[model samples]
Target chain A: MSDGAVHCVVVTPEKTELDVRCDSLILPMYDGELGVYPGRAPMVGRLGFGLLKIKSAGKEDVWFVDGGFVQVTREAVQVLTDRVMRRDQIDRTAAEADLQKALEIKPTSPEASALRDRSLAAARAKIRLSSR
Target chain B: MANIRQLDKRRKSVRNIRKITRTMELIATARFKKAMDRAAAATDYTKAITKIVQDLAKSGTDVTHPLLMPHESVKAVDMLVLTANRGLCGGYNGSVVRAALQKRAEIKEQADSGCTSVSGKRGISAFRFANVPVEKTYTEFDDQPSFDAVAKIADELISRYITGRIDRVDVAYTRFVSSSKQIPVVETLLPFSGIEVPQDDSAKGSKIRDDYEFLPSAAGILEEVVPASFRARLFKCFLDAAVSEQIARMVAMKSATENAGDLIKSLSRTFNRARQSKITQEIMEIIGGVEALG
Candidate 1:
């Protein structure tokens, strides 16, 4: 409700993961990372599999957001993704195993390649976020 | 009068039936709670994505996606009927089948060809008995419908719509209004106009910020968002159907249990009366024998 603070909400298919007010926020866009401040213009960005950093006051909350879409409005920054997890939620061994499995897939067809690529990206993001 | 032993046997069977119905009622109640929680959790995501799609459609940017564009001429149509796989849920499956048949007839009147796909065994069997031809039948979905499972269906429908294989997609499902209320209805899913802007104060409050800056581009985002939203909507239908089926089963089983209780009570009353009458007859016979001997 304040002018200098940004409100962030992360929504997944299962539930609304988090809703909090923060001083600033960073989203991993399809191309790169984009930061949002209180007075940022409204925008919609495609999310990539990476960490979503939200900072309020001095503490920061990091979330591993799977690929989806993000909509930024004046009042709130909405992250619409299939899954969102904290660092602790990501299992390193499982993600690593998934990456290995994804890497072994032969891209024989276009659909297969797409599947392989998506899995590879997702697993890699999970591994990377969890390592941090 | 009926034999007292036969009456007792009937009463025992009724008591056993009551136990089974009561147990089923409890199971349905628990499942209903879980399913309702799942559906409630999905509401936020569904509402958010729908709102985004609505705002994009009303953004007036000449943004047109294939999913958002209506076909010029109606031709082939796809109807997906969602019913419970197992039937014990009173008229849940029946009403859904009726609604689906009604929708199919309406579509036939308007379209040249219609393809019917049904999920759940009850629906498939109903369609078969009705002599209606079904293009596909699915038995995988139960009380818990995963988003991925629903996404596969939505993707197939989307591809069909895009390739002009079908002009529109209609889903006949029971919409769960609350724990106590559910209504079976057919909803249009393609040419994707089902997302209506609510006339509530929230709609007025969240004015479609038309000045939205597209990160990559409006067209690119619309391409992804439109389909994602469509998938979300379809998935929501599955979730609602699941929850409603549980509720219907719970109510049906509760009534069954109550009716069984009443049946058992009446059976016991008759059994007692029969036994009493048998005893009185035996006593009368003994007294008559004594009088004859005297």
Candidate 2:
């Protein structure tokens, strides 16, 4: 921690993506967004696909995360998910192609609809990241 | 001269074989290092997942996750045997198949029947020679096992176990103990007996437990994390098996090259001896002819 900064760690299945000391963080939650500062209450919440804003050491680092879980405690903040990519890694063209395919799903059943919806959300998240 | 020519041919063939084995040994060594790194990289993720499991266990909850409990009654089971796809790996594949067969035999009467699926052709052939019926065989895998591939297999096994189609799921693979030692062992995956974390986790586990608010609910996350952790463990098993396979290949090829060297040496010695005796016999016969004339 850089003089009272909160520790933030982003972990994925393949690797520990990042561990840094950030003054503040804004994480995506299921319904909306979550922002945490130093000395936050220990809480765990389901995550969503959106940008994670980390302000640390007088610099800003951003990452686009796929849904998983985020936990905050007095010690640090931990975000565990399957996919975490930086802004540069997002492929807008691929996401667009996936959206085109996902839109074609007729979704005749509940499961199909949910699958389509998730894919749509994922594609949209990709597009949003790429545009930024 | 004829004998010398024969020996030279044999020596040349042996030398060629030694060259090939030596190259293979070097390749296997390089591959083993890469596999070892991948296996080591996966260790942190595996350990983290284990820590999460431990925390869940300590969270003072009922811990009634579906994955944590074994299904009632011993019905049919599923066993996946992992072996090298290619041969010349010494006893690497042999040990895996042997351990799996032993386990399968031990549970013969207990379970009504079992499905034995093998990864790699070596195990499949071994089972075939033994007249053991293999339910399925996978040969697409190489030294590096893609997580998605292993995950797909693990997911299917887990789902099958959950649906009561299989009461137990066991994996027979070589566990990488160290550079010089690897042991083939059978591990129960379904009915997921708790994870084995590295030693560091045990030491740090004593830290005061954080009061974590449930995300959606603890049960919901448990539903995901439990199986995810199981998947992680299964993937790690594949990684360890890969590293072990490369090590086995390296050692096997090295010994093969050494044997070729020994064979070449002996063959040349015999050729020299044969040539010397032939020359001596010819010279003695000529001298005997001269003495007879005198």
lDDT of 2 at B28: 99
Candidate 1, residues B146-250: lDDT per residue as tens digits?
886787689678766776678988999999887789999999889997555544335466545447777687666766677777888898899999999999998
| Model 2 Cα shift for residue A36 (angstroms) | 3.6
Which portions of model 2 miss their true places by more than 4 Å?
A1-6, A20-23, A45-68, A71-76, A85-132, B195-209, B285-294
Supply the DockQ value of model 1.
Answer: 0.37
Q: Rate the local accuracy (lDDT) of all candidates.
A: 0.84, 0.80
lDDT per residue, candidate 2, B97-199, as tens digits? 9999899898887886578899998999999999999988999888888766776687677656655678888899999888998999999887887654233
Q: In angstroms, how far off is B16's CA in candidate 1?
A: 1.1
- The local lDDT score (0 to 100) that residue B71 gets in candidate 2 is 78
* Number of residue pairs clashing in candidate 1, backbone atoms closer than 3 angstroms, sequence gap of 3 or more or interchain: 0
- Give me candidate 2's TM-score against the actual structure: 0.80
What does the lDDT come to for candidate 2? 0.80
